[model samples]
Target: MATSVLVLGAGFGGMELATVLSDELDEAEVTLIDKGDSFVFGYSKLDVMFGREPAAAVKLPYAEFTKPGVTPLREEVTQIDPEAKRVVTDSGEHEGDHLVVALGADYDFDATPGLAEVDSEFYSVAGAEKMAAAIPEFSQGRAVIGVCGAPFKCPPAPSEAALLLNDDLISRGVRDDCEITFLMPLPSPVPPSPETSEALLAEFADRDIHFVPGARIA
Candidate 1:
């Protein structure tokens, strides 16, 4: 009998792993389960949030993932039992010969105070869309983007959001009235690579984007 595998999460990593396993292991049973009905890539989230692209354009329907030996289950996993090799999801209980947990990191807005209160054009798609909807209404206002912690998803995204906001204001002929700034805890835009950091610094300077480094705003 073939091994029955239950893969948790439908993110990029999990999807890739399951696809590879299904291709390599012919007789094995692989099930990819996620709570979300649609799959959206990381970058696509930004695209929709900034109003550069529509939500439907970024959404990939779960039903479209038709591959051999791969079953996509749209359900939220409630609990896991390692000893029994079983997982309980909103759909039902599943016993797998093998289990792969590729669930991505969950964002905790509570990580920083005033984050939820303030307008975050970063983080999640819904947040971005909210900002996008607000952007068109703002004829002149300070649009500040802040990063509260390390190990964030899409490190360059916050900066990108600032730049995009700058662009949007410029396109709307309100660049002169709009003030865009980026706040980060790092000493540079991208501290991992100095050259990249320097380049980003130059770009920010050129774009007139105020860069606040090594400072965590309250």
Candidate 2:
């Protein structure tokens, strides 16, 4: 009997895993599932937010993804039985020899008080698109990139947003008018690599991008 591998979520990790497995094991059955029919790169959100790329241009349809021995299914996962290597989805239940769960983190806007009403979060695609539309009208103001909590995934995202915002504002001839601040709970921009953190700090200083270390938004 052929080995069956089930992967939950169609994000980068899931898709790569399924593809590699299909290529390595010809007899293996790879099932990749996700709630959404398309995949969007995390950095692509920033591209859309900054008007560099449209929302439609960033989306990669699952229907277009083709790999030998790999089956892509769009279904909401209702339950996961890790021990039994079984998964229950909205469509049906599936049993597999191996189960890989790569569902990304859920962003809860309500976690921070007054955040949903005032500021836009670029972490999500919807938020990015909404901010993209609003950026053109934003002539001048204090643009704050704040991390509400620690241990958040993608540590470089806020820094990238700050840099990109500076570039966008400069292109719009409003760079001098707007003040950009990056607030994070970490002591450094990127703790793992001092060299990277130093380079980022230099760029922030040169661009007049304020870095608030060991700070978190309430």
Most TM-score-accurate candidate = 2
Full-model lDDT, candidate 2: 0.91
lDDT of residue 76 for candidate 1? 95
Worst 10 residues of 2 by lDDT: 118-127
The sequence of per-residue lDDT tens digits that candidate 1 reaches over residues 1-218 is 98899999988987898889878986868889999988888887678776888777888998898778889999899999987888999879988888888889998787678777875544666876786687789878787788878767877877777788788888899999978889998788777789988888898999999999987766
Which pairs of residues have clashing backbones in candidate 2? none
Tens-place lDDT digits, model 2, residues 1-218: 89999999989899989888988996979999999989998899999999989999999999999998889999999999999999999999998999999997887779889999976878888999999998889888898889998788788888898999899899989999999999988999988889999999999999999999999898
Off by over 4 Å in 1: none
Backbone clashes counted, model 2: 0
- What's the residue-level lDDT of 195 in candidate 1? 91
lDDT of each: 0.83, 0.91
